[model samples]
Target: MNVLRVAVSAALLLSNAFAAAVPSIKYCQNPRAVNTDYVGRDKNVLVQYTACDGVATTQIARAIEARQSNNVCGAPYNTSCFTPSGGGPDPNDCHVITDALLYDSQNIGALFTLDPAQNTSLITMTYQSCESFMVNQDNVALTYCRTDWASILDNLAFNCQATQNAHGGLSVATDQEWFIQVQHS
Candidate 1:
């Protein structure tokens, strides 16, 4: 009886620990689409719609590729061009469709918007809650770290949050401050 009780307690503890380790989803803005028109002249371009967390990067990449190639055209028909790639989409090629194709930047601030419905599978990097640890119970530190589980959670959370709010009728707004810098400078 004693051994069985210990085993049950250990199992319960392990279960809780595993649950805690599972990361939660967090919304992340799409990275700015850098205009790859010229090297060292990367500029942020405005987009009509923003990508959603539920969308896959590969899908977005495929869509952009099709659009660029002009293999697909029209509204509803053209929309199919943005389908996620079944094989694998190159992250480098996936970008926002503006006046022209642009490169993707890591900086979240640089992200442009894309039509979530049209490009239902294009999302930027996933986000996780920043973690911190105390040193000697006197100092605290926080850092945003990436984990596979965390990335999945962030994507789920972002999708849920976006869906709950206005049924996913969200729009991407360019940071006016950042735009000013790019425009003036």
Candidate 2:
């Protein structure tokens, strides 16, 4: 059984990414078309028509591997995408879980708005968070995602009480602010 499993795993990885791997936690390549699209190699660009939470739109572009690539033209590839508690491999900003694609681009523009507070504020290289230790005594951590050229801030906020309890009863306050200077190439 172990031998069979190993062989299967190796074969899949071998057949996986012949082209440049997309900055995706998980992805499938389309072999027939330009070899890759939002859907898959040569697959139809599926879209789902749904109303936005508070925004309304009149049109959206046809779903396709954005031709004429430039800066920020490809899908948002954030390896540091979030995982909801207890959920496996949460789809971050640029990743799409199977069956999550829509039927068309008629309403996708509505999904493009950026909240100044949550989306625009810049982060430093040494960002800090205490929310995890504060709530469940879990240590806070930060990492960079080369996939999307983005910084991932996880478990923000601090709780001194939870930190002390989680770390052998030593009172430790998570610094409210920190820096994470990212050098883009």
Candidate 3:
């Protein structure tokens, strides 16, 4: 009887420990479709919509890739074109700030709007929280799509805090004025 009691106690302790060790799953919001006019205008373009909050960078990269191609007629590449199709303030001002086709492996790319006539301003795209990071360069706002959470945290941690508000959207805030200096190629 003593041995059996000890065995049962050990089993219960092990079970409790194992239960406590389990990690809870974290949830992120889905991506949604915004700027449908851009999708409608282009026949070759595809849009995968979801809630902007908690979207992974890999998904954004896929959406960007869906709009990219080499045979398409464009200025950046006559022989090849690797550009994403998303509408913004300036229809002709958006381009991949990272290596054109290499964004797939890199899992992130910075996009900017170049108007050269206005001071940098935050361009609002009501589609994704990722776009909220956009800041106008000359006159065009700089934008980014990222895949890695760690990298995102590293860059935005210093000044930005992303929190889920009552409206079920991610809101980012900074302690003071926010400014980001990005180099373009």
Candidate 4:
């Protein structure tokens, strides 16, 4: 009986140690536009935001929260969705747009900033419906500054527009596009 008790206690201690060593997994709904029929023929209009390397989903949520708190129509303009708390365009987070082609592909917006001192970078990409503006009707523009690429902004703009156009017209049959921008300092 004493040996049985000792074995059980050892098992419990080992289980507790293992549990303490495991990191928790958490998921947050991304604020980007998503397609309802992403898995089928009639795609809906909801997009999910994903985290980049060295960045956490919680950080992205915080950034969304920050942007939403400051502006009524912040990025990923999902009025019906909830914004993340304690994160928004801060120095520690990087943002990207997940669904830019659902509406007017030309109006997607994103911002990127890097702070070498803190070893952190922040990116905020907005996937909103583009208004009917005459100028630059087909082009989605973004400003980017990077150490390796002098024309990073131009590259980002080109990439964003191309991705948007690749969706082939905003319809139920099209797949979603993700426009990403990166900054290193």
Tell me, by TM-score, which candidate is best. 3
1-185, model 1: which lDDT tens digit per residue?
A: 32223222322322221122211112212422222122111443222112223423356555464233221111110000111222211212221111122123233322232232333112222101211110000011111112211222222223323223311111111211000000000
TM-score of each: 0.14, 0.16, 0.19, 0.17
> 1 or 3, which is superior by lDDT?
3
- List the candidates ranked by lDDT, beginning with the highest: 3, 4, 1, 2
* Best lDDT among the predictions, by candidate number: 3
Q: lDDT of each prediction vs. the true structure?
A: 0.20, 0.19, 0.22, 0.21
Per-residue lDDT of 1-185 in model 4, one digit per residue for the tens?
A: 32223222322322221121111112211211121112111232222212213333246555454233121112221001012222112112111122223221323333322221121121222222211000000011222222112122223333333223221011010111111222111
For every candidate in turn, the CA RMSD to the true structure comes to: 21.6, 19.9, 23.0, 21.4
In terms of lDDT, model 1 sits at 0.20
Better of 3 and 4 by lDDT: 3
lDDT of 4 at 51: 21
The worst-scoring run of ten residues by lDDT in candidate 4 lies at 130-139
RMSD of 4: 21.4
Please identify which of the two predictions, 2 or 4, would achieve the higher lDDT against the true structure. 4
